[model samples]
Target: MLRHLIARFVFLLAAICAPVLATPAMAATDVSTPWTDEDFASLRLISAQTQTGSSDTLRLGLEFELQPEWKIYWRSAGDAGFPPQLDWTGSQNVGDANILWPAPHRFSIFGLETFGYKNHVILPIDVAIPDRTQSVAINLDVDYLVCSDICIPAAATFALDIPANGNPDTSTSGASTVSTHAHEIEKFVSKVPLTGDNLPIQVSNVFATKDGDATQLHLSVDGLSNAGVTVDDILVESPLRIGFGAPVAVNKDGESNNRHFTVPVFGLNADQDLASETVTVTVIAGPLAIEQSRTVANGPTDASAQGEPLGADTMAPATGAGANIWLIGLFALFGGLILNVMPCVLPVLSIKVMSAINARDGEISRVRSGFLASAAGIITSFWLIAAVLIAIKLAGGSIGWGIQFQQPLFLTVMTIILALFALNMWGLFEINGSDNLGTAANDVINQQEKGGRHLSSHFMTGMFATLLATPCSAPFLGTAVGFALAGSSFDIIWIFTLLGVGLATPYLAIALQPRLAHALPKPGRWMSVVKAVLGLALVGTAIWLLSILAVQIGLGGAIAVGVGLVLGAVFVWARKRSQNLRPRFVFTALAVTGFLVALFAPGFSKPPAPSSVSTAATGPLDWQTFAPETIPALIADGKTVFVDVTAEWCVSCQVNKKLVLETAELAEFFANDDIILMQADWTRPDPEIADYLASYGRYGIPFNAVFGPNAPKGVLLSELLSRDAVLDAIKDARSTAGLASN
Candidate 1:
């Protein structure tokens, strides 16, 4: 019995030791295939004999040892070359496999750029095991392209097997199995780009502009300067079929702590629009690198353009030429006086006329008080605008006239305000002192004379008038605003103050000579007819605002908002018609609710689908959507280009388009095959269009520029367009093109 027990124990021990002795031999046997072309690179598959922790997942690596001067492509191969691909269809017990890519270097060949690794690279592969009890076998068929003077395609098949239960340390028998390459794996693992939540570097602003046939992108990197790092190069990756050139550093006058880089983008498909596309920019500084993605806009925002002000250098030429500051002020004054006749301001000006008419029979002192208050309000509003422009300039941002119209929130709020004003004018409800001049004068005469609210009401009317005048750029107003915005903070304040004084001159004159009001007819039923007519004008303005909103939100959303306004107006009328206070209060509450619904309904809807008319077809004379690169290409092809930078909010732009550019004669002249007409609609905020406008040292709209072979830089037109001016510009451009050709 003793002998039998000893023999049984020995048999059990041998059975366990037998597998352990053979495990080393399995681990030592190479599972990697020989390199097909060792002169370029050597490929292999490596894995660990023992699994780490309690996880059923195994870590493997696709290792490549590249020879000197040979390289492999990254996931985004800048201008050319294909990234490495792996096929694992011939594997077993592998649930999924993912290859991790490391940060790559930018290689510039001639003018073309590429991103890849030049030295030995190891792509760590994570293999998932569905059943840990069963052994895992991985068979990888790799296809990769290596390049030097030329690119060469290479392929190889690698097989790796992991044992279910293997002791890595004690495996002495050289069995064919997995072994640890943890040191090599960990070295390259650190090279992989950091992801998931915390990133070291941040990209603050990215702006793109058209540079001839290429796109110039400016990237502002934050914290790079504080860290004492220099950006060696940058790589831009886009889904569109475009190519990128090498990145160059941009130096600004007063900004040193911030790093700015400009990279040239090439090969943009003329048939596609870049407004909705996104680009990923990777900045590689010494010992540090960061990758960020941003949507491609026309140009950078005020925050992005802070370090570099728009038209700063261009304005230098004007200042150096001894431009008269007083002359500019006089021009601003004339522009402000003429602003009263502009279509956009005419509706609001009707309120001022009503004030004068209502004050005809009132006390002379009261008339003087109301007109003076209105003048004060205009000047104060202008000062406020000046303050905002100065503040933006101090912060290193670009400032343009009527930039508030670029904001969708501003547009939406203004629309609602105009609608409510129209409703009040139509007698749906009456604000205490806002109904008309007669009501306001009565409130002033009957209420506390010292603390009357009518003065503030009249003042607000003046402010509102100034606000309405912003979207229309008058002749002298454009030049004055451009010069003021481009000048120092003090200059901005001074010029704007003059502009306000000019706008308020009419009211001030009436206030000084109270007899002006005495000449007007007395307040009677006729005044009601005049008020109704002005109310209709306000309603027309409201409708135009809705049309602008339709471009951003959608036609459906705009219609919903219009319906809500009508419903709210109905409830307001019900409130006024109610016989009892309780019924009236209930109707008022319902009206408020309806108004709230209308105000927010557009936020819930998706943006409208872009019109097919803008994207359908292309012809030389067919008005193509404005793109920066389009101008240079057209000029290069020996064609004359006419660019119209207009917006729906710009009343002046509409008038010019209808009366001059779209006329039969003008259209026929532009119909020539060698003439290209491009329209850059600025109904919404477009940074690229802003930048293009800045390049000409002009900020106001209804801007036209003609580019031909001779005037390759471009010849700018005035804020107001005329038939003669358009024809003369076209003729000059053609003459210049002919001269250049000769």
Candidate 2:
């Protein structure tokens, strides 16, 4: 038993260690530097002189010229990297060099979002130059990283002279450039339409609605009723995730007395129901930007609340910490029971039950041995799974469930198993009866396949079927495993053990029943038909597996899968057609050719997807994606960051996604520079990503850590989150990042 366990353990280890080969087209060596050779990668200062009587009137600026295609870190760089650091020490007669960031873009990389600049970006700084000084020299030192395929450290010292007698005309270049970039950045950052004093717009009402499966935010503006005056720019600041699925045009022509606007929340799918809650909206009209905080009726609000909207802040408080171990264990047990219904486990159960039906007349010892052998297979398979997970975690791979299936090779293996099983069921190969078969007629006939009687075969079958079951995790299983993954090692073992036992219970019950062996059906012609049907089912499943090949490898590569299948079928057919020695030679040649083709399939030899592509964005973030590094930078520049780490297989993750992450307040909070929200997808295990989570002292998903100026270390949120909770975090992070106290 120990040897068997060791062998299984070794195989599991090997599977995890196997390289995910990269194709030449997708493979590239890591660059030595994150900065472009020609770029001024750190901070620069630009100042504009204001009119007279303005005691030290000058707008100071922090300009960052990032390399083309490469980016500098944001306040929160998401899963990795640090935000840019700037210090201003050497200065004459300057009270403080306050940095004013125009806005930042959300940058998505390797399944994480960060807010920062790509190409060249300049953040304008506003400084009140004291009039008493004849001349002012502003000296600043900046440290930051420039990243392309890899990151490189960069720093620069900048000093700018402000002439006490210089003409306002001399400041055109600095003034114009700063103004232009600020407007450009704002264009991208403005998701929630804010109505500050700069925009002459007033919100009469703000409503939240569920449009089919998506949540949407509707706005009614009071001052928008004027004719000839239009609402050209509409940005939202609320946390109800909202975006335009189609192109949106805001033309303020001042014709109507009131105007209503609606935007669909991005990333939120159909996994949740809408609820009533207080919300806020930011409206940007002609020359004013108005921010209106109000309590909107929650969960599909009615039209009665329109125009009478009470402006109030209704942000929800974030849930602190997490549930205890016992709660998680209960969730795990329920998850285990649900695993019994997964399609992946169903077939294996069918095979076992069928075996039991056939061996009705076998001795208690033989029947018990078969049952024990199957049970052993289930347990052993789970051990192998746990071992692989543990090994990968040790190897710095923060992998989650179903991540292996993302690889084409694993899918190919599944395809091969289903195909082989189908062919066998079709009676392409036959064997003599097993020595252990009882006197039952049905047992005698079907047990002819002595190869399946081997303990190893039963074990392999259990393991293989479990692999198939990885994709369809029951709701209970997801929460259980999710909790286990986030908890202590002891919890992981016990939770997983409970699941294994749950899966093996049926087989155990039949094994313990000795007299049940006499119930086997008689061997008859109907048996052949049943086997043929099973064969067809297997073949159908194989085809389904083949169909998924197109998602990872393009259509041409999927065609290769079909060709490989045909080649394998031909080889099988050729073997069946041959009876003579010369024919055997032809059959052997065909089989070898088929084997080579299967091994050489183009999809099998490719490298795993790059570390830059994140599959977690319900779809994909807008072109302007953000990172974690942007958080500190935004805070330093006075902005908030909302961090979300989620996964596809995690049902709870999805539920929260539809509920909070995709809400307008949240999405707009992310879209605006006021608060930068970035998502880290833990759907697939990447070593770099694993290292990232470990840095946070977490080993699993649904983890949220929010950072603000007030709370730099970040407040860890509970596994289950709500829309209000997210907004409150944003408010806190914003207050902290924006320096509310100082």
Candidate 3:
């Protein structure tokens, strides 16, 4: 019995020491043995010789071939599962080793989205060879988890040997064994995400803000949106012991072509200083993926920064601030003065002209009362606009100039008003016994007979003019309106009042100068001709309003409105020609019914899908539909972008497009492959476009801007675009980019 126990102990001791003695010999040569975990996965150790800079590096690959529906975790194993951990202590002549991970896919099992790899994957271990004169032996004991429906832990020991200076002929077979595994290792090297300077994507800015107990990272990526690229997952790779939730895209107010991602980070200590920490973000967009590193700043470092804390008490400062308030007010004044010439406001001009003509025969007191009422009307409308802006701002909503033009209801109502006014000008109807001002002699008689009501008409005309002018933006108006909207409530009111004052300046001058009215052609047959001309202008204005209505509603709704306007016009004409009071009342009732039908008919139809209305040719310089998210990418790619923010309702925008942008000279210039012409049509209500407009501090359309490599922030163009102006902007942008590159 004693002899049997001694023999058993010797046998067990040899069994334990046998594998340890054989490890050195196994590692001395390339030990490639296939490892299988049941039927789920198969892994093997492979070795290759690679050149990194001036060093001969030994590349060892832990290649895994998984069965269908099975997957393994990535380095930053999100949600669940552990990444493969390697024990390199048993390896020889290996100064250092690193596992290079490829970009992972987001797997949604149940309701959880986990990051892992399916099918075949190779985890490349770059072994640093300390001495080129000596062979290097690598041994790895890896512990990894694989999952199908359930996860299973597996362990394996892998060994590989690389000859001195990667020489294969020194081996026992005198063959290049490292070359045999070269293709397999190269396959995975290509799969590894581009890092550092090799990354194709560019990160513009990264910001961190504390939201309750979690931290939100606002990442702004350039060119991602413009390329129509969308990310599936963003993994935060950092040494900090924190957990991150799935990334949610946050659309910045004015940046349609730029991508903004909001990533929620947990496990942040209250006292942690985010400004000093570096973060690596791996973005996987379709088949392409990139890894970029950036320092997390406390606040937004760029103008595109968004995703602020929900409970913050104060509003962030406006991006535009340096302009002098007095200068902006002056611009507002000039813009208002120029607004008088816009087609939308031309109908109001006729009213002003008629008032001036009527005042030519009246006393100074009557003229003063009439002009003062008009001025009061203008000022009151401006104040009302200010009140609406304040209400919107206080409610934590965005406010822009002429934003009402985007509302279908507002457009419908304005169309009805303009249509009726046009009919009145056309002698279908008369207001306050004025006889539609069909003849100058009749107008003179009416003004003499009803002076008080005539003054009221003048007042309403001024209010109507101001209302119409809101849809058009003039030179310097953007600067003024931007300042006002971004300023305090009091500033908004004060600045808008100044704008009204500017608009009324011409009327005030005419009222103060009685000789101005005398300079007009005498009230005769010429008055009839002038009335007809003014009536045509009003009709044109109504048509313009309806065109916008067509975009807001649909073609069907627009047709209905046209029919309603015609019916209303016929009834108004019948009422004007009627001799009996009952017949006139019946005609008036018909007109009212038609007007109501016109106003609400659009509400019943579905709005048509917005389509691109760009006139640029589909060639090298094809006009892209304006997407704010994509602008960054275009600029980054060294393309000069010309952005035109226009609307169908804006008369100035149409004028600019017809007169300057669509000209042969401009078209030729835009045909350059390096130049991208993009149009943002604000013909309908679009929150994305509205927010983009607000970002530039503009609330109105006909906004043109240029973006280039150097001017990624963009340079605003004049409201009235000229051929020279656009060409000059492009030239300047190119020159700026050249300078920046130099």
Cα TM-score per model? 0.54, 0.44, 0.54
lDDT by residue (1-742, candidate 1, tens digit) is 1232233234323322332332332222233444545678988877743442234577777788898899999998877899889898878888887777766776766767778887788787787788766777778889999999878999988776666755433322223233335434544655565442234456656777775566677677666657555555667788888777766655566464666666666777666556647888776655456677777776675453434433322111112123467778888898888887877787686677777887898788888888998899788878877876666545433457776665444555566666666766667764222248647656555675444334766676677678767888888888888778766687788889999998999999999998899998877889888888888887788788788778767788878777877787898889778768677778878877877777787678677654523331222336776765657777888888888887778899878877777778887878777788888776655444554675555767878888886567677788888999877777766645454443
lDDT of 2 by residue, 371-396 (tens): 76766766666665666665544332
Alpha carbon RMSD to native, model 3: 27.0
What candidate 2 gets wrong by more than 4 Å, as runs, is: 1-330, 347-350, 430-454, 514-520, 602-742
Per-prediction CA RMSD (Å): 26.2, 20.9, 27.0
Reference-based lDDT, each prediction: 0.69, 0.53, 0.69
By lDDT, the candidates rank as 3, 1, 2
Candidate 2 at residue 277, lDDT?
44
